[model samples]
Target chain A: MSGEMYIPTYQDMLDAHERIKPYIRETPVRTSAYLNELSGAELFFKCENFQEPGAFKVRGASNAVFGLDEEQAKKGVATHSSGNHASCLSYAAMKRGIPCNVVMPRTAPQAKKDTVKRYGGNITECDPSTSSREETFAKVQAETGGDFVHPYNDPRVIAGQGTCAREFMEQTGGLDMVVAPIGGGGMISGTCLTLSHQAPETQIIAAEPEQADDAYRSFKAGHIIADDAPKTIADGLLVPLKDLTWHFVSNHVTDILTASEEEIIDAMKLTWKHLRIVMEASSSVPLATILKNKDRFAGKRVGIIITGGNVDLDKLPWLK
Target chain B: MSGEMYIPTYQDMLDAHERIKPYIRETPVRTSAYLNELSGAELFFKCENFQEPGAFKVRGASNAVFGLDEEQAKKGVATHSSGNHASCLSYAAMKRGIPCNVVMPRTAPQAKKDTVKRYGGNITECDPSTSSREETFAKVQAETGGDFVHPYNDPRVIAGQGTCAREFMEQTGGLDMVVAPIGGGGMISGTCLTLSHQAPETQIIAAEPEQADDAYRSFKAGHIIADDAPKTIADGLLVPLKDLTWHFVSNHVTDILTASEEEIIDAMKLTWKHLRIVMEASSSVPLATILKNKDRFAGKRVGIIITGGNVDLDKLPWLK
Candidate 1:
């Protein structure tokens, strides 16, 4: 890999923001006095859940999809995701009048498949296993020649996600710390890329579900740790960190925290009760971490990224 | 009643907005492309659900609570309600550091009671009948010498509610039609008062559940139509209209529409899905009506008021 691959500068994020502005929402910064009191910290929630495609993934997806050259765009974009990234990429591609091919596990939620299809995405199903998915995705990419946009590991996608923290700093002035859930570390890496350059004083924290603590372990070990199928209700944060993400994670992230399953669920319900936003389980990890480690965040102005709102209403964790 | 009771002018709404600006939030306006396509209308949702007390009732409640004279303020405010109005009034009064006495039905939701108490409002339980509630409220008012603030009928409350429509018009640059669910007609009357004076070109529409269609019947009959303990999933909108609200509803409202229980739930779920907000079932009436009568609203700019988000999460109708 080229040295350029490791360096996605603040300028890249600025460019991504400008490029994706027309295709994405400048989602609102929301607050809850009740939540602030409960955590003993002033919390500002960057509500990416309100994005048109219902996730911050849209920002990265739109940046990558919109940045393509006419010739490259004509061939379209492809990704392997059964989560927000698939639908978000599809939405961005559809907005830019390009085809999007999403390879998903056949067992993926029907609601997710419906969203991807609704956004004009063509889906190719694979077996549930990672090897099968990879094999199937490789064949699809080779056959279609569509540009592969890795969910979080790509430099372009990382730069796109970093725009959120830029907007966050502008919207909330500046925060003492910014926390977000780590799936494949796209958002955390993006956050690190922006805050480490723009507001070095501000801390970047990555929250992970305890059950899927590969990123947490990686952060402590100073190396990438890959988890095959860690189970958590925060289905959106199932993926482990890749090298590109690990590059940012190891260098800029101040701390990586973990929340237990029960804590994550409680925080999710609390946010719904207090913020009144339909956020996903993955989004609640930051709040869960804050609540669990109140001493670390208390009395600080904290910004929490509410990642997405695309959960299956029929299979809500609390109901289950 | 005095002639002034029936004449809450646009000036009142303007003054109310200024008076309550310190206490109540100028809630964000949200939009959903999916909802726009489904209804065939461009819908701007004024999310009063984001209010501190989780409802638009706070606008009116804050106005009444804050507008009280020194002598009257000493007694604080008293109201009898089993819904958002009760907690909202309590919240407003508490913000002003005054006593708030709410006479609620004994069977009211525990969640509602907790919120009222959390806001430092004292609650008095009634027998779940209009007569009993009124009697209980009278006793509380007489004993405490607290000023009575009717849920909808009071001119102060009507003026306060009108501020929302003023903001809605400003936020979305004035819609072709502004629709809100009519219970005792507080919010609808407020919309009528503001739109009739400030934006006469904009039509004001009231929506109600078919099961509790007293507002619809009243609009058609040109008189008040009260239903005895009407029941609908939109529990916030079970009250009947009073004289003060009736004046605005009859004079300025262009239409009063009704949606079935199933339609209301469906629209509520759709908004939660697409808009990603936890709005009350009553707030979904406008979207339900718009979907039911698409030809009338198709291609038009419509403003829908998301009145509240205070619902018992444990008892979500869809889950049940």
Candidate 2:
């Protein structure tokens, strides 16, 4: 495997911004005095939860699929997931009229599967574990001759993820800090890469839910930590840091912070209450961090990348 | 009572828009292929849920409060509501550094009271079922010598509501149909007024929940209907339609449509899921109608006014 930065340069992000212009939405840069006062920070929300596929995964997946050559495209695209990435890839492939095969964990919630099916993806469910999903995906890719798109740890994927940060920085000039929840390093790594160059003054913050703090631990240890066992309301943040994402984040990101389960739930409700933006627990990572570390961010210009809105209602902890 | 068109002219709406520009948000227009496809309509959601005080009611409240003379401003403004309008009036008054009084039903959600208090408004509560919140508001006004701003039946308020349609049509050219939820009929009447004169080609739809079908009954009768009991999941739509709002709706609005409780819940959830914006049951009314009457809207451009996001999470049906 290539040890080099998987993502292309800032110039590539600029180019992707143009290439995906026809497809990706330039989501709103939202602000409020109410939120500002609560956080003690001047906040700008780069609402990727409002993105076309209801997640930033679309940005990377769309770019990867569309950037492919006709010969490669004819092979179609394949992935392994049962979350936003699967649906995003499925939707993006369907948009280009390419067949999509997704190998999902058998234990993946039905909501995610239903959404993927809505976009006409063929789903193969295996054992509820990474080894099984990966093995099934490899077999499927071999069977269909489909191009495999990694969820976060690929060059094309990271390049696409960087586009969100590039657009965000352009929308709100010179942010003092940028915050986002870290699951795998796909979002924050690309975010770090983009903000490191475009708005060099901006500090990058990786927010992680405490119940699933693999990234936080990895940052502290200066190495990658792949979490095999996980339990959290934020299902999206359950994935541990991968090698490429680890390298990307270690070089570009400045700090990582954690929020407790209670904090995650509170922040989720707060986002719903104030912004009218319904987000899953993973999306609340920023709000949870901000609320927990108010002193660190007071009076600074902050931008939060809300990742997605795909939440399982039955699993919502606040349904009391 | 003035037997007149409360919001009599388009200019009033324009003036209100300009006056409230500093405080009120010109909320974004959200478009979702998923929503448009589901409803069988090309939809542009004018998101007033992001507006100041979390509702369109702020526009009128801001206009009325800011337009007052110095002596009148010193006396301040007062209103009665169990929901959005109370917060809207309080917020507008606070922005002008004026004292605001809100008389609400004691049964008003604790969330609304908390927000009003947070904004520093004086509150008076009375029985909502057995007694009139309006009569209490009048008493509060009489004692305080403040001007009474009727929730929806006021001229300045209707003018404020009209601004939504003005911005909607301005942002996206000539909508084929404009749909808004009707409670006291302020939003529909004002939106219809703007559409009738400015974009005459556009048809107006008033979305009313089946449980509270006053607007539907009024439309069928070809005259204003009042002196009736009201009930609905859309709490904001329970108030009887006023005479002034009736006249405007009768003349300009094409029809009134009703949605079931399940439709309202699903539509509300869909709006939050797709738009990532919070909307109350009242705010969901227009979306509910589109989903209910899918045949009329296929392939046609339509505008849906998301009225407000002032919902109490503690009172959420999902919690139950």
Candidate 3:
């Protein structure tokens, strides 16, 4: 179900960029000769994994937390998340000296919960169900009188995410194509928003896991199609497309490509080996897609967003 | 056992920097707030792990390969190394389209041998003993008529390595202290050479694994103390210092520090956790020493040389 929200403008993204510049890192873009030889494409990786909270989610989270007026900020912000967004929001809120409440499923990994708690987030656990999460979140927000910050569907969050691509363009000058993993479509929508306005000649490519290929189907059907509980190693991309994200994804996206779980993990390991950097499985989807579809990207200067680096060290898939 | 050689001057380092600029990566200097807070100092990691051949060794190897005269170049280059130097020399030679002969120990890790072969180096395995290795290397050089390029002992290699610290100074402006792991004293000697000439006000600190603390003992004894077979997880730092390396180490180093095996591994894991980059166990010695000697480094801007990222993935220490 696509949630209805005001479409963020180019000016909104610019404002978000200015607002969040001080709090976030201007993460470096890295390249690897071995990776280029493998794909036959010159690739530049925008390493958001180097962000303080260890993910690009901090960009949007910081923008949302900082954009709140003094009165609203005092009430603080709340969200229902069990991933990087939860930790990033808590980190941003803590930095702003405001309270943050997160509604997480009780079954969420302890490592995820610990990260949120480490950032001073107050956790309110619900059963692993959408109804339970919504009911618990509503009560928590009511008790705290906090503003709800939807992870991807909110205009402010999407606008905040848009700044990443803006920075990418400035850093690399320009790229022939930009690729990013599509989860709830926050990062992808942000890419579309920025590139469509700033660099329309640059194509936007969304990568998805085969097990959770709703975005691919949705693109083909010309509408939003989302899976509720698709299981994949890319845990961050389990969420489906919402209307705010769908608006950008359907219109601006060049294509949605898919890769098998094995391919995704292989790409993740290869990235760790060649890039000499740690990145999560979800972030590897773009590389997986690029390797699988070399004809499309070969000889092109491609920019890939390494969305995050929040994998549980003990549970690295290769180790298993 | 130390062999005498002409000491390289400051101009040698400058020449090396200019010579290897195109062949090597001017790897980025990265910082982490968490790491800085832990050490109570601002730390800049000069990431040589990002080098094309995955180590700072490429700096020296490229210089040696490219500095050869037309006739000497036709003869090619040869060295006996079981670590980063072997692969780096091969990579540099491959780039220059010259024959590279690496005389590796028969007991050297298969992964290392594979890397040398991947770069088109002819591998000649010798018995894992000093006399055996040297004799084998001599025979190989005689048969191939290749110019000898010692891993760390040669003045050419030392001059080449000094380029890393020179770049670090230019990249970070200047630092109060510079730290690097000391094995055969190649990287540390280079650091001392560059910092002493360019940033004379900066202190040069040498870090060594306690299990292989010959350099530490040598500093205190005021004479080179060679270690025959000291064992350490930092495999890259097992080589003993020769007269050429000893000259720089003894003359310019501010202090030599040693870290326990446990401490080195912990720092390595912590770096990977915070810096979000892969680095070898040898590279983590600087951070380990900083953590141990916080009083000396507190509040200072310190540059740490992450010497390499060449680790056997299947045998990651933490996994064991």
Candidate 4:
């Protein structure tokens, strides 16, 4: 599956949406008058956080697991993720009655690990570094003889992620622009994939934490950039963009923006206070960028994809 | 308006629904599979907390504000509340381009006061005690000539709150029982008012904090039990039931259950962690009682009213 990179087309996304519909929630879209007033934009939040697995990655994970042919289903699926993707994949696999193996950083939040285990995913821990994660994942895949489902790089996963944009477009009618946090670029790439076909006039923006700005740097430099172990409180977004995600990011994303750690935390707390929903810090990057760049978004109908809500309640960033 | 006790009828509730339709949100009902598995009950959460003013009170507040005649509308509306009602009333009045006067205990959470002010409500501070609040409110009302809208006791307000149950029944098709926290008994009374007419077979259960269980005592003693100042982490349920609310509680309520402060806090955090919604501790009482009396709700369809989401994020009860 990794030899030659295949870009997921709009048809693949449409098919993925139909395949994953039974397994995923077409989560509700939420709006905050306070946030709209503050940003001077009509903001619509596609609440993927409210998904049963508490993340949008479930859309992609379910697509990958259910799309498996009967023969390939016997091998099950495997992936390495710092948080949501691992648990989401396990959830999808469990629903399909297939074994799921996850290689996770030892330092991943205990809450995340608990969720993965709850979904019956077998966990093999690796060091927190990227090199250690890749090396450990390779060994696990070989030993388990599992089908590798890369967290964000696989065409199946990206196509699955694109389903969110399809729902967002239907729910909001149309939007001037869509903003999403870019980690490994799975969500953003998916947004680009669907919107490029369905709402070509709509601009796509990728938000990144300044502390881990590989995606933002790549967009500006006109090439892919890899960050080994960038540090940020938005743990879900530390990975570098791969070739498949880069294909969409490079072509369809109109802009890449970065926000400070402090701004991201502030935006997160503000959402919890006003929007009244618990969401991860990584999801806050888009709001932080919008707040910082109000003129760019003001008076426009904006769609912000809230990626996930799986946070360790005891270890909230602001509490420290 | 206070001379003879007026009972709100089912027709009044139907009328209130139409009056408030443009101003209030028909909040979505949320379900948690994890919670359903734990309680052995199919629980449907009518998320009133997602209301724009962050409370179910907006339904009643909007009804009262919009039902006014031209001369009465000029006078505007007033209410004395410890928290949510003050802000909600202010929000409703602001929408109609009318004045909203609020009599609030100076001791109310600053977050609540800020919300009231943000909605352009004129606030008159009073002492924390019930007597002081009423005394101050009388003077303020006399001076301003504002129409008094009781937090939970008025027929107009009860009729307005009844609309929630109407939507709940429509949303869930039907439920075996409906549970809500008993504060001034406004919400519970409203539930009884609607269900007695719409779905008479559905049981109405009221949950109360044991520390401030005046409603529970009142239910047992067959009379009103007023507690001047009761202490509990659930600040919303401290008020005693008034005559209009007492009428419904005595006739229609199946039971009044109480939960310990610790149990309420635990349920609040559990909902936050699993349901991923920011809600007030007051809203957790229903879940607390449901957990304690699992056998009563087991295998039955239960509707839980999430009363409000106006909390001081800086001082979450569990964190303290």
Candidate 5:
């Protein structure tokens, strides 16, 4: 019953793409001729990494922000993120000239916070400990009368993220497999739902960080799994699973694959070297999964969604 | 009379894109929403910067290698370069299973040489002077019975490079202006000729480096102008104007604009930061021109061709 709540129809994705088209980019699809030959598979990279605010989160954020009723939208939008979503929400709301509030863990990277600031978001820093951020966000929302914008879990948010799959389908038509990184399952949930309806024959693989294996665990247990401690360079993926996302992922997903941080970093470097585009560690998760499970996808037409590109070039350790 | 020898026909470009379609990438077209808002003009980037072998040279190289007759193809290929052309030729020939030799200047960056090596091209280094590199390449061609693949002079090569324009015409059919970076004039020649026929209403602009203003001088003097010990940060644009490219450029090119090296560097950084693509100095030339001549292009639909991205990170001043 819970699973059915998240399995959206292909038509739903199409409508969502149309709704968010004004706010989000129909990011280009890049092909690697060399990689295609080497892998003996036709590969299409849906470069959501180049989306507005530099990640696919903009799709979900913009959709969620726009979905808010005039009464709710007038109060402005609030979200807990010092990452892509924070920047995305700020940018989307700024486009509407609406005030935005972001509750960021104090430990969040400076680059991400700077991004949010540039887009006119009011920032409230909170302790990194679990309870502090939510508590601070609640206080901020109470004072500002802001509507809460969940990063994922909400139907409107997942529907917004689903636009990526819709564009992928339009650009490359169909694929034998669709692979995307799984954090709290926003991207994967949208992808699995969209693929199951649009390209039923296509398999959906969720690539997760090994250190943050909550999504993988949730997939196996058919319930939400929360990890208290997570360590990985994929900072975008440290968040634990949510009940709504778990509902979609458990029913429509194929299987979850995990990649070590080192593998993710290597993939990120390879993308930079060969593709000539910046890719963050979390964005490289799908490529890492592909590297780990090479045999599972031989000769199949594969689509890889590069989810984000908010990398700090000045501090990238691997560059040295 | 010498200038008349370089003119290219519109029909040749249309045919070239068709002939080279299977072997080359159309490359994606990117529209920067922020730039559009900033300039009050819609802008499209033809990112040949992401082309195979990291630049638009591959379009020419692939055409030259594949256009060879049975006997010529069997003889293999050779060329002399200090930039994108060398790696592109080597890569094209290697993909066709033909032996390739490149006579590169000793001053050419090591990273470029490594790209040639990875594609299995035999390299013979000579001094940076044109005559010396030509002599070395001649000797290698004579000894190895290889066909010489001139970087930009040959009709086939010019026609091949024109394929990039073909794809641009396909992606963005109507444009008020089309701009391209000028080096040996190959890329712009192809573009001008193609757009002249395919999109006759479009105005064409050539953006060249101030230090290496051979193409600009040629356009002004109505003849091919050779660089006299010119210097510029755009390594791909080091060469003086070749005779064949001069004719095509002269007849169709509207005007040429030159930019300072600092402007080019700034453009490079902006492209990387905003677009997330690491474009080299040559690829940044059009953007540099746009920045310099902002008043001229206001409220117009402008298309810029980003020529390549095979830059060495270690040698980059920004990295330092």
Candidate 6:
């Protein structure tokens, strides 16, 4: 499974869905008439924020955890994530009654660290840099002999994330286009994988923060653009796209759009105010881009994937 | 309909459900595993906050606005409310293409006023006192000859609000008890009206803020006890129970509970952090009471009605 990059097929996603059914929620899709009127598009929100662990990453994490063989499961699963992925993996591992180890940035939000700890995941902190994360994660994995589940790069994770798109399409009947926030491109790549097969006509759009516009730049340059410790209010979207996710993003994504940090924050507030849901700044990227590029989405049936809702209530970006 | 106090029967609720089906939302019910574990109860949250107008009052507002005769409709509808009821009534009036005259305190939250205006309701500001409000409302009603839609005291409104409990029962199969915040007792009265007949075994509990515990005092004293002006973070629950609402409260409510201002605020933040939904502090009272009195609710299947979500994002209670 590790020699060459293994590309997951549609059948893989179908199989993952059945495997994770007991652990993941088929979260409800919500709509806002006011938002529809403002955006000039009929919008459907796939509320992954409503997931039990409060994120869509659970789908992929559950797939990877449950898919492991009994021998491999005993060693448990490990990942390096600064946010939702770390906690989601921990949650999945806890459900399967196995130990989970996480390598996270020392500076990650306390709320995120609390979630991972609450789920009984052992956390080893690393400096907030790619080199330090990899180095720390390597040592942790070697010591524990745990299965490494890459947050977005692995085939099993991407296929697991693809199930969200399948549910979204079924819930909305069919959409003209689907928009999702892109960081490592896991959710976007998964959306592309599902729509490219099930509903080819539905365009896949990736939204990114202008502060961390690596994905947008990569799409324009036709090559991955890795950033060095990029900073943004959308902390979840700081990572660069990996080769496996890049393959789908380069081939299937119709376009990659970027929104300013202010726009992202504003959209987050607008969604909370109008849609009446508590979601993270990262999840607001898609809506920010859609509102900024209204002409592109006007009068279309658009599906927006709300990736997660895990945020610090006391220190909201707007208040800060 | 006006001579004697008409109690809304179960049949009235059934009819109201059908009549307002097109105008209101059958808002989704949500559950939180974390909250369930913390409270020692299986809790179902009937998210009235998800309504298009962002409240359960829309059901009652829609019932009154749409059930009017053509002669009364031509004159339009009027109400005086400081919060969700104003916006919700305006929303219903706009749907029926009738003029909605809202008499509101000049100091009502700007967010609330904006909503009523956005829904095409005319706002006639009055002083923040019962006498001033009634005097101003009387002048406005006389000038327009509009029918007054009492926020909770009207039979039509009570029947309409009862539909929420009907949906709650259907969504949860059945619950051991249902808890709702008692403002003017509109929502609580409606819950009692529905459960008293539809699911007679289900107990109806009313929650109130300790700061403004008129309902709690009234229940204990075996009579009405109105507060001239009670201050609390739960601004929605400041109003006293009217005669019609009192009738249901005295006859059917199992018990009334109260929570401190700090407790209500903490519960509001906890709900937003865990349930991932934006709801008013007023709606947090039920959960606050449940958390405070865990022994009474342990091992019970309880339904908590999330009354509304029209809060100023810039001024969250916890942030303040």
Chain A TM-scores for all candidates read 0.98, 0.96, 0.98, 0.96, 0.94, 0.97
The sequence of per-residue lDDT tens digits that candidate 5 reaches over residues A153-220 is: 76777877888887898889788899888888889888876777778788899999999998898778
Model 4 chain A lowest lDDT segment of ten? A1-10
Interface DockQ of each model: 0.81, 0.67, 0.70, 0.80, 0.49, 0.90
Which stretches of candidate 1 lie above 4 Å from their native place?
Answer: A1-4, B2-6
Write the candidate numbers in order of decreasing DockQ.
Answer: 6, 1, 4, 3, 2, 5
Model 2 chain B scores worst on lDDT over the 10 consecutive residues at B1-10
lDDT of 1 by residue, B1-320 (tens): 64556678788889999999999898999998998888889999999999988999999999999999988998999988878888999999988999999999999878889999999999999998879988898899999999988888988899999999988988998799998998999999899888888899999989999999998898888889999879999988888888888888999999988999999999998998899999899999999999999999989999999999986667677888
lDDT of each: 0.91, 0.84, 0.92, 0.92, 0.82, 0.94
Per model, how much of the real contact set is kept? Answer: 0.68, 0.68, 0.55, 0.68, 0.41, 0.91
Sequence-dependent TM-score of model 3:
0.97
Of candidates 6 and 3, the better by lDDT: 6
CAPRI tier of model 4 = medium
Which is the better candidate, 1 or 3, if ranked by TM-score? Answer: 1
i-RMSD of model 6 (Å, 1 decimal) = 0.7
lDDT for model 2:
0.84
Q: Using TM-score as the measure, name the better of candidate 5 and candidate 6.
A: 6
TM-score: which is higher, 3 or 5? 3
TM of chain B vs. native, candidate 5:
0.94
Task: Give candidate 1's error at residue A95 in angstroms.
Answer: 1.0
lDDT of 4 by residue, B1-320 (tens): 44788899999999999999999999999999899998999999999999998999998898899999989899899888867889999999999999999998888777778889999999999987769988999998898889998888888899999999999999999999999999898899889999999899999999999999999999999999998679999988888888889999999999999999999999999899888999999999999999999999999999999999987777788888
Best by DockQ: 6
Q: Which regions of candidate 5 fall more than 4 Å away from where they truly are?
A: A1-14, A37-41, A106-110, A127-129, A217-223, B1-6, B94-97, B106-110, B117-120, B125-132, B197-201, B217-225
If scored against the real structure, what TM-score would every candidate get?
0.98, 0.97, 0.97, 0.98, 0.91, 0.98
Q: Model 1, A316: alpha-carbon shift in Å?
A: 1.6
Taking all chains together, the TM-score of candidate 4 against the true structure is 0.98
